[model samples]
Target: MAARLPALRHRDFRALWIGSACSSISLWTLLLGNAWIVYKLSDSSLWVGVSTFASMSPYLVAPLGGMVADRAERRILVRVTRLATFGVTITLTLLALANVIEVWMVVSLAFVQGIIRSVEIPSDQALLANVVPISDLGNAVALTSTTQHGSRAAGPLLAGPLLATIGVEGAYGISALFALLAFASVRRVSVSSRGGVTRLRDVGENMREGMVYIGRTPEVAAIFILVFAHCSLTMSFDAMLPGFAETRLHSPSGGFTIMTFGVGVGALVGTFVLAMTTGARRGPLLLGTALASGISPMLMAGSHHVPHAAVGAILMGSSQAMFMALSAVLLQEVVPDHIRGRVMSLYLMSAGGVMAFMNLGFGAMADRTGAPILFFLPGAAFVVITLASIATGPYLRRIYRTGTAVAVAPAA
Candidate 1:
């Protein structure tokens, strides 16, 4: 096997990757801490969903952010976003320290963070292509997934103790420090701009072009459908996990941490395995992983035991990580550099925007039908979606015939 992680050979990519991992860790810490606090305060599953919705709803503006990303200097955009996150976290920390932090405060700040992330997500993904050669893009994306999942493991594990000892204020303080470090790290990455002084008029034109690009390209269009389905059907379940951990598993915050820890471990393993593959068929891998993701959640729905639920979490995490990482690799490889940011922003919108709306529904559904039904129904629907995509989606068929499609002509 040629080295498992060729992307790390590039210094700028290494710096960007490490910084992203730290930032991801901090974000997850904030999420878990906030979720746990909400659950403790309200004892309501709906609020947990609402908290997630607040954080992700800003993705409605992702297209605007994407236009900015395509036109602006990505490194500078990322730095500004991180700085915004730092301010939000620090303010939240101070609020918690004052012993007056309320659910509304958390939701409002999360909405602000979501707005910053609207810029950060696409800009960050678009910038990754600048740091590494095209040949190493897949490896870079996989490694990024590994970092994301690894941080998932570290964050919840850290959150429990931080909550028990230093309290929510301490957790937010630590999160702020991590955000500051992420901001500092982005300062070191240099990107050469190709879009050149984009006029305000260009945003509308660019947005239209991006929409046309997807509409005209079958393969690209299929990728977005799959991403949207996964996010809406499977990822929405994440917001309901705290209730599952407490009521179904009958475990405290510690058990919730363990289940998420299992998920992180599996995701790390899946990303590492994908990183090492030289001839993996992207279509079959994506379809199979999607099926696995669906099946795993169904397993959780049936499990009366904590270990089984943990195992289910791990499987779902693994499949989800692989699907997302591969989709990113493929999208970056195929998209024209000039419009990469806009396209990536659309992808982000598919994930964040769709999941944002679905989360509220999932929360409401869980309250009525119970969390297990939410898991079983969506899990079943995902498997059907994957199978249907395979039968109908031309992009998947192309992947099956060829090992991969690392390069497809950019859209008209």
Candidate 2:
């Protein structure tokens, strides 16, 4: 197994992977907890969107976070950032237990969580490369991305039962517990990645260098565009899940948990398969899954029963998760270590930052036109984009044929 999964051969990477899995649980639970709390308080899907927006908008500042990651001791940054996450979750738990948690308060706390995540993610991504040898970097990244994203389904699934049984306060408290566990796991990692000292004044130049590097690398740039569109169109729909649950599925028990679980199950399978698979067929798999990503949402939009919605959710989750993890793996392979954190920040911005605003837009539209069109239109547009790319975009087509990240940039 160690030979098969090379990244798992490293003790620190193993520990870090376990730590990140726990952190994924906490972050996802917090997101769903905040969404449910905000929805309950305001009874408005729009405000639920606001909650998502607040939590993810911090990715806009992630480049600064990336700068910090590159300059500081990355191991310490991972430990400290996750520790701060525990603190934030505990505060939410305390406030909710007091019965004083308002929608505004939830939104505000989510923003704080977002800020911590902005710093946490870049450090985490940059740190992944340090723990494993270059030979294992691809598997390390695939596994990390899978754990961070594919396992995210566990969050909403965990929250579903907790929210049903113990209330959002209990959910928040459990999330904090997991966050603390995550902190503990990562604290045991020994490596300290301290690059050259980069002062605050040099941030602009550093940022520009990262941007320039990306511009020069067309493969990375294309993946960035694809990830941005995926997040904005498909991933942003999470904020609308409450409405999607209550109105569309018509499940008597409020099918939010079940729906998310289905998505989680599919995502787990999708990402795990990609992570575990060997070379060849990856290009076809990536392209096929991306195309399916569009179709799945339309299935959800057209669903008339819980079972149908679950099937759609499963498909949606699998397709989207596969595409995200593969794209991340591609980026990791091609990027040089010097600017890895900065480039990764832009990737975060594409996913989280773009989702933040798109959530707001989707939420507003959900109230006006209901969730069907919200799902259908984006799925349709993405389908069109996919077809166009296949037809004319030779770079993307080459990626589809070779199953590798082409055009690796030179070291700075």
Candidate 3:
């Protein structure tokens, strides 16, 4: 079992894994709580989009966050920022329990958390690279994502009970508890850098360097483009799910919880399978997952019941998890350590930015055209783009066929 899951053998990686799992669970639950509250308050899909948008809009400054990670002790930054978030979340929980919380307050809290995430995310990514050797990075990435996607099931699973019984305020309280756990869990991570204060150089130059390097590296550019398109068109459906659950499925919070939790279960199962493979030479599998990612949403488009929609959610989760992990492993293998944090930040920024803004548009579109169109159209566009990537780029096609586009992860 250790051989199959090499990353878990590392003590530090285990700590980071636990922290990330808790953090992800907190995020998904808080997001569900926030979106549900917004929907109840405004009764509009567009407002739900705004609530979701607040959760990721801070990625607009991802480069700065990246620079911070590169210049500082990545784990320390993550812990410190996580602590700050814990303080804020606790206060918010108190407010919610007092029955004084409002829609704007929830959205505003999400934005604050999002801003912190813009910094903490890159730090965690960089820190993982530091803790695990390159030979294990692929498995490490896969496993880390496993926690993220898998814990989504836990998040929404917890949310359903909490929301049904104690209300969204109770959801906020549980989310805060997770935040505190995230802060405590990372205390064991050893620092690797002297930190930003000592290594500090010209911030503007560093930021520009990260961008210029991506522009110069065609493979990285292509990957970022693909991630952006995939996230914006196919995966940025959090905003539309409210309308989809309430209007289309007619089950409200129950359907919403099932859909989100199913994604987590499928993602957990899919990425865990990939992690157990013991190598990165699975490009054909990656292509298949990417295609499945698009097709899954299309399946959701026709679903009229909870069970059917749950199946689609599972497929979407599994496919997206594999595709994302494979792409991340490939990028990590190629990018040098000097700028790893910056590049990783920008890479996620590519996904987050588009997803953030487009969520607003998706919400409005879901309102005007019905939630089903939101599902069908983005899936169709993603399929067209995925096919176009194969048609237009011989290099990309080769990666798919050989699975050797990146250095193979070592078999333990």
Model 2 has an lDDT value of 0.85
Top of the candidates by lDDT: 2
Q: What TM-score, computed on C-alpha atoms, does each candidate reach?
A: 0.95, 0.97, 0.95
Off by over 4 Å in 2: none
TM-score (C-alpha, index-matched) for candidate 3: 0.95
For model 2, state the Cα shift of residue 43 in Å.
Answer: 1.2
lDDT tens readout by residue for model 2, 19-129: 999999899888878877887778678999999999999999899888888788899999999999999999999998999999988999899999999999998999898
The alpha-carbon RMSD values of the candidates against the true structure, listed in the order shown, are 1.8, 1.4, 3.2
| Residue pair clashes in candidate 2 | none
Screening candidate 1 with a backbone cut-off below 3 angstroms (N, C-alpha, C), the clashing residue pairs are none
List model 3 lDDT by residue over 85-190, tens digit each.
7876787778878888888887888899899999998889888887888899888988988888788788888878888788888887878889889888999877
Please state the error at residue 151 of candidate 1 in Å.
1.7
Cα lDDT tens digits, model 1, 7-58, are 9898888878887987887787788777877777878789988998999999
Sorted on lDDT, best first, the list reads 2, 3, 1
Candidate 1 achieves a global lDDT of: 0.81
The candidate that wins on TM-score is: 2
Better candidate number, 2 or 3, judged by lDDT: 2
